[model samples]
Target: MSMIEFKLNGKPVAFDGNPLKRLLDVIRDDFGITGTKEGCGEGECGACSVLKDGKLVTSCIIPVGAVGGCEIITIEGLRDTPQGKCLVESFAEGGAVQCGFCIPGMVMAAEALLMNNPHPTEADIRLAISGNICRCTGYDLIVESILLASKKGEGLW
Candidate 1:
């Protein structure tokens, strides 16, 4: 086991695990941050999305060793941010969630997108969240909520 040091949710954290262990497992199992889901173990799906140094990343495929010295942001980290709450509220109001499995990752992806481009067009929103698949919602409402949030200026970083 190797000791890894990083910042999670804006706080310092350390964990002992295999160097190649997935960051998603470390966050969910070791740190009790279950918001980062394990959908496809590969990087194809954004189910394990997290922000590494303010950029959207798939935690499931990232090794713990690669995360050291970086700041990490999970869905839970957004509770204290206006952007996070706004998007969540909009998602609910827009009926963007169903089954709820993909909500966390989708939200994180949306946050990253909105932070970079608060006024993203529909195509931008679609491309940004394309990695995340929601088997339940068919993505119509999801896109709608993001577009709505963008127009409202909720995604400003």
Candidate 2:
């Protein structure tokens, strides 16, 4: 076992476990942050998405040892920010959520895209969330919700 330290949702966190344990497991089992779901347990599904140092990553494929000294942001972390709130409200207003299995990762992907490109086009929105898959909402509402959130400008940052 190794002691890995990192920042989670703006707070410092430490985990003592196998260095190679999947980050998804560490976040969910060790840290008790259940918002980062495990879908495929592989990189194919975006259900395990998280932000490591402001970059979107699939926690399921990432090793806990690789995240030391990094800033990891899970869905719970996003809920604590204005941008997160905007995304959630936009998703609800646009009716982009259903079943909710994919919403958390979708939200994080949207947040990363908006933070980098405040004025993204429809194509940009689609491309940003391409890694995330939703079985509900037909993606139209999800696209619309991202567009709506993008329209909110800096307030989301």
Candidate 3:
């Protein structure tokens, strides 16, 4: 076991555990942050997506040791921010969410995209969420929701 330290959400966290442990497990099992789900452990599905140093990554395939000194943001963390709230509201308003399993990852992806480009085009929205697979709601509503959020741009930086 090794001591791993990193910033989670907005707080500094340190813990001693197997350095090779999957980040998804550490976030959910150890930290009790279940917002990051495990859909495909191989990183194909974006359900376990999170922001590592402001970049979207699959937590399932990333070892805890690799994230030391990096800033990680899970869906729970995103929900607390204004941009996250806007995405949530826009997703709901545009009926982009269904079954709810994929929304968290989708939201994180959208958040990352908007943070980088607040006024993304339709193609950009599609490209941004391309990694996230939503079996419930089709891509149309999701894209529309992102467009709506882009128009709002209240919380996005």
What lDDT is reached at residue 66 by model 1?
A: 98
Evaluate model 1: give its TM-score: 0.95
Candidate 3 root-mean-square deviation in Å:
1.0
Q: Write the per-residue lDDT of candidate 3 for residues 1-157, one digit (tens) a residue.
A: 8999999998999869999999999999999999899998999879999999999999999999999999999989988788888889999999998899999999999988988998889999889889998999999999999899888865556
* Model 1 weakest lDDT span, ten residues long: 148-157
The per-candidate count of clashes, in order, stands at 0, 0, 0
Residue pairs with backbone atoms closer than 3 Å in model 1 (clashes): none
TM-score of 3: 0.97
**What TM-scores do the predictions have?**
0.95, 0.97, 0.97
Q: What does the lDDT read for residue 66 in candidate 3?
A: 98
Give the Cα error of residue 87 in candidate 3, in Å: 0.5
